[model samples]
Target chain A: SAVISQKPSRDICQRGTSLTIQCQVDSQVTMMFWYRQQPGQSLTLIATANQGSEATYESGFVIDKFPISRPNLTFSTLTVSNMSPEDSSIYLCSAPLWGTDTQYFGPGTRLTVL
Target chain B: QKEVEQDPGPLSVPEGAIVSLNCTYSNSAFQYFMWYRQYSRKGPELLMYTYSSGNKEDGRFTAQVDKSSKYISLFIRDSQPSDSATYLCAMSAMTSYDKVIFGPGTSLSVIP
Candidate 1:
């Protein structure tokens, strides 16, 4: 198991503003992921962040809207640009346990766009 | 049909009762099955994970996978109030780094 933490545990942002959520892991990992989950809904993968390379985004998400930065193995960031009401959801970061199929998640950053 | 489908049940059960949650998927390519527990305003925590078929038990939680039917289940024995949360079933075709498909999640409430 790994201890993961996210910054700005909860934030309220204005429309058209941008917010960056940070994810820090206790141990170095090969891959980190960003996810968006609406209240009472399932989780949706936004992108895959790998160190030293561009983040691989899912079909509906784009870099222009959700830019990811993986500066190191233990840390990454996800920025929601030009925020709208639709972007008001819980943003979570997760990393899989090394050599195991289990993945651990951060506490999640709850973003509320006004 | 959705790739993954869950009951989405706000199931309420009495403490000490057995609780069962289920999910069905259309993707036979999925080989990894997992159960996650998510409390309100919290990230999901992996409760049980099983590869391929058969059953795996962790404490009071049992996870079962039947590839032929493309269905999976999570059972909790002697449920407690602390177990109240939304249960989500997740699956992946390859490694953990691969894209994981998640179910709609079923909300469970173990009343005291």
Candidate 2:
């Protein structure tokens, strides 16, 4: 099992502004995942960030819109740029314990764009 | 069709009653199955995990997987109000790095 934490539990932001959410893990990991859960929807993968490589984004997500940074093994940040009401959702970060199929998720960061 | 399908139910049950949640998938390659419990406005917490077929029990939670039918279930015995939340079923094929697909969770309310 792993412990994960995210900064800014909940925030209200205006449209067109950007907010960066941070995720930290207790132990080193090769990959970290970012996910978004829109109201009444399932979690959609935003991207997968490695320590030294560019984040791999899923379809419908772009680096310029939802840029991610993984500076080290246990820390990563996702910046939501030029936010809109459509971006209002809960964002979560997860790390799969190496050598296992289990996944650990952090307390999500809820963003509300008005 | 999407890889995974689940009833996004707002199922209500009384305390001490049995609660059952289910999900189905089109992909037979998925070998690992898991259940996650998500509270309102919080990230999902892992509840039960199973590999391949059969049933695994942990306390009041029981996870069952039927790989042949591509179906999975989570049964909560002696449900409590604390069990009120959304239950999401997730699965992966071969590795953790693989694209893990999550079902559209079922919302459950265990009345006190």
Candidate 3:
């Protein structure tokens, strides 16, 4: 297991504003992923943050709405742009540790777009 | 249908009671199965993991995987009030490490 940390543990933002959440891993990871968990809902994959390349987003999500950056193997950032109340959810970052089948998650950012 | 399905259980049980949690998956290609426990206002912590099929036991928790039925289960013996949390099941294929799919969590409350 790796030590994963996320910044801005909880934030209340106005609609139409943007919030950036940062993820840092204690050790380098092979792949990084962003996920969203709505209230009383299952988690949904938002995108895969690839180092030195554009993030690969899942269906119903686009880069313009949730742009991500992975400048290095140990760090990544996700920005929720033009937020809405519907975007009120917990955002998390996770990555697979080397030679392991399990993926570890950060504490997550609780964003409330009011 | 979703790739993984789990009952959104707010199951309440007394302390020392045996607890059962389960998940079913539609994708047979998934090779790695995992169970995670998430407390309120916290990220999920990996509790149990198994590859292929069979049962793995650690401490008071037992994880069972039945690939033939595309089902999996987690059993906790002597449940504690501190064990109350949302339990999530996750899986991944051999194809990539970034495509792990998570099921809807089951909320459990073990009252003392």
Best by lDDT: 1
How does model 2 fare in lDDT?
0.91
Candidate of highest DockQ: 1
Pull out the clashing pairs in model 1: none
Question: lDDT per prediction?
Answer: 0.94, 0.91, 0.92
Clashes of 2: 0
Q: Give me the candidate number with maximum TM-score.
A: 1
Q: Write the per-residue lDDT of candidate 3 for residues B1-112, one digit (tens) a residue.
A: 9999998789999999999999999999998889999999999888998988999999999999999999999999999999999999988886324578899999999999
What shift in Å separates residue A16 of candidate 3 from its native position after superposition? 0.7
User: For residues A1-114, could you state the per-residue lDDT of candidate 1 as single tens digits?
Assistant: 569999989999999999999999999999999999987789999999999999999999999999999999999999999999999999999998676657899999999999
Just chain B of model 2: what TM-score?
0.96
Stretches off by above 4 angstroms in model 1 are none
Error of 3 at A18 (Å): 0.7
Question: Candidate 2 regions off by >4 Å?
Answer: A98-100
By lDDT, is 1 or 3 better?
Answer: 1
Error of 3 at A69 (Å): 0.4
lDDT by residue (A1-114, candidate 3, tens digit) is 469999999999999999999999999886899999999987889999878888999999999999999999999999999999999999999988877767788999999989
Model 1 per-residue lDDT tens digits across residues B1-112 = 9999999799999999999999999999999998999999889998998999999999999999999999999999999999999999999998644799999999999999
Better of 2 and 3 by TM-score: 3
